[model samples]
Target chain A: MQYPEPIARLIDSYMKLPGIGEKSATRLAFYTLGMSDADVDNFAKSLRAVKRDLHYCSVCGNITEDDPCPICKDKTRDQSRVLVVERSRDIMAMERMKEYHGLYHVLHGTISPSEGTGPQDINLESLLKRLEAHKEIQEVIVATNASLDGETTAQYLAHLIKPAGIKVTRLAHGLSAGADIDYTDEVTLFRAVQGRTEM
Target chain B: MQYPEPIARLIDSYMKLPGIGEKSATRLAFYTLGMSDADVDNFAKSLRAVKRDLHYCSVCGNITEDDPCPICKDKTRDQSRVLVVERSRDIMAMERMKEYHGLYHVLHGTISPSEGTGPQDINLESLLKRLEAHKEIQEVIVATNASLDGETTAQYLAHLIKPAGIKVTRLAHGLSAGADIDYTDEVTLFRAVQGRTEM
Candidate 1:
């Protein structure tokens, strides 16, 4: 039997989210139905608040409440060294490390021809503008993932920035922390051996 | 660094859901931020609608948008045989099989002394009243889960209904389908052997 109207609509709405399927949507809809009125109202308000309050940072394309994000406006941060990531979420991953003091530039996406995403489609223009405007910026770290599209985008960015007389670097490839040497993949093992450091 | 105010609030709201952790909450909040404004509005509206519209079915105790749930109100179902389930969701599982044509009585919860849930706490009073009022009901198939509380609830229900000359039955227990013999536990294997039927 079909669910009641409101339940069905809620399930359909939940199905639009990323990684949520029919079963998960049904479960979430039912769970929402069981929630208290006050809690549900707060949840609904939170959903609207996300869209209503937050906007993209004009400087680096990161989502923020203000025009220039807190990260961009922070004078204490190392603005001379900027870490370029594929998405705003990547900034959180870097921040969790608590080591990097440099500012960030969110590309929003990588240059993927198969997915019809080109250099112009992403936030590349803003990154170039930011670099040109900020003469003190000495290094640009291309911290994209180690996928084909990521590598391609990194190469394209390096080609664009190198001619402008700015140093470009990619994240080092090696064995991950707590990973066993016996189970390590061949390519990573090769990189680890090739880039071995002398004590 | 922590997320902006709206984003942080959204993440906190998501973290309150069952089985969702901090990582999943963060992922969901970011995904919500990426959604279009129209999509976000629909999602928020759905959450509010669930709490605002749906309510308990007075007749069967199942949650519904109407007074009497569709299942309880249907004339085509076998009114003489009522499947007694612990929760409203259990009725959905039974209906998915497309075999059960009987009406249902949702108990809302089982009698669990450890959790402070008793017969009075659940929808048992309405079930007793329904049975007393409707002389057509001949059988009650207890479809509670195979847990300690479920077994206790079934026994209590049988003792209460048997005096009224109503046939009370419990769902059979055995090994589940697609389960490997090596991985199957001892108690289930014993039940499987004991409850073996002629082919």
Candidate 2:
């Protein structure tokens, strides 16, 4: 039996989100139906607001209500050190730790040849321009994921920045905290041994 | 660091959805931010439309754009039999089977006293009224779940409908099809033995 038009439409919209399947979309649609009109309006408004109000930060490529984003505009953050990440969401992760007080450069995505995403496709051009314009910036920390594409992007960024006489570094790879040594994957174990810290 | 107002609000709305946690909400919010304007507008509109357009069918409690609902209006269905279910979603499950061509009565919820949900809180009044108004309904099938509240609701519905001199039936409880005997719970195995068929 066919669902009502509105419910079907809602389910289809929900299915477009990442990781949500048919069953989950149906469940979410029903849940949305059960919500109060005010709550539903708020939810809908939030969805529109995210798209309508936000834009890419001019300086860093992160999403922001303002042009430069709060992080980029803040003068107190270390201007000499720049942490380059694959997406704006990764910036949130780093911010949550509260340990890093440096500026950020969002790549939006990594260089993936299989996906046909090259250096020209992502936010790499702006990073190079920013580096060229800001000679005081001494170090660029490449904090992309441990995946092949992420490594390729980091290496590519290093190659581009090293000639400009700026230090380019990638995040260290090791076994994660609370990980069991016996169950750790070979790559992580190998990295942990290779990058062993001095006690 | 706090997320931008729009992003934070979007994440908060996503978190309100069932089965979505903080991490998933963050992921969904970022995904929403990345969506094209038209796609975002469609998502937002769908949410609003589901709540604004859909209403309960007057004949049955199932959700629909029409007052009587398509199922209730369909003349080909067996009007003499009414299958009672806990929610509108359950009606979809029954419809998917393509076997039951009877009318439906959605209670919207069960008689759970601990949750302060009594018969008066649900759509039972309309069911009784419908039964009284239409004498042609030969059987009232109490297809509530097999949980404590579901059983209580089924028994209560049976008691209410039996005095009208109509047939009242509950769904059979037994081992599910393709269930492993070794892994089967004792209650299900016992029920399967007790409800054994002659065939």
Candidate 3:
């Protein structure tokens, strides 16, 4: 069905997101249409402010309103370890666990040969520069998801860090805490068998 | 997990919607944060404009930028039979069906005593005034949802309109097309039996 010009334009903009489709875009557009002028303005203002007021942390590449970001600048956080992740969302997840006191390095994306994504495509150079500048960093942990590209990126990072005399470890993979063996994916089952630990 | 002030404010705003939870709000907020400056600005502007520019149609209470709304002003549409619905969304749904060519009246809410909603709370008065003024109006279809409040409102309006000499009817209540007889609810089955037709 055809929508008015402004409504169509708004729907098209919403459909550009990674997961959103035409139906959802139309729903969102109609929802927007129902909103009061002030509320709609506020929503639009917030969207604009997000892009205007935020930037990537210079040191870690984590999203931040400030240059260094709160985590990177904190004097109490452990400086001898760094957790490398695929995106800022992963950084948010790690922060939620409250178990990580080290700093973070956001790669922005993984190196996927099929996707034409390589080491040079991501912010890997900054990580190397951080390694060279920070003498206190004794360990780097690769916390990317246990996917094919994630594994490859971890391996590549491990190799790059080894010559600098820093220990690099990938996050452990095994049977999930409550998962049934039969229902587990084949790759996860294989990893569980390969990384079998003592009882 | 705690976020910076601006981020927290934005997330809270997103969380105010019906289906959105704290985590989803965070995700949406971050997604907004990653958007381009122009995209963000446009989204914010649309939100503001939606609320500011659009006003309820004085005649039918449907949302509109103009006074009477496009449907009410259209000379070609049949105004003799008016379809009454609970909200703007319902109007959109009926429009999508493309079978109904009559005009519409948006109540903006259903008459729910439990929620402190009554006839006065919606656009019922305006609807009555429209019917009173228009002598050509022959039938009014109460197309509200098949819920307790919808039925109550329809019955109340039917009683109110009986003395005015205008025909009032509720939408047909029966097993929907393609629905199995066994799957239909008790109330629907009862209504279907009570309103049964000749072969």
TM-score of the B chain in each candidate versus the native B chain: 0.94, 0.96, 0.92
Give the alpha carbon lDDT tens digit for every residue of A55-136 in model 1: 9998888999998999999999998999999989899889989999999999989999889999988899988988999998
Which portions of model 2 show Cα errors greater than 4 Å?
none
Tens-place lDDT digits, model 3, residues A95-181: 889999999999999999989999999889999999999999999999998888998899999989998899998888989889999
User: Compared with the true structure, what per-residue lDDT tens digits does model 2 show for residues A123-186?
Assistant: 9999999998998899999999999999999999998889989999999999898999999999
User: Which clashing pairs does model 1 show?
Assistant: none
Please write out the lDDT profile of model 2 over residues B1-199, one tens digit for every residue. Answer: 8889999998989999999999999999999887888888998899999988999998999999988899999999899999999999999999999999999999999999889899999999999999999999999999999899999999999988999999999899998889998999998899899999999
lDDT of all predictions, in order shown? 0.91, 0.93, 0.82
* TM-score per candidate for chain A alone: 0.95, 0.97, 0.95
Docking class of 1: medium
The TM-score-based order of candidates, best leading, equals 2, 1, 3
In candidate 3, stretches whose alpha carbon ends up further than 4 angstroms from where it belongs are A1-18, A21-39, A175-199, B175-199
Of the true interface contacts, the fraction found in model 3 is 0.40
Q: Comparing to the true complex, what docking class would candidate 2 get?
A: high
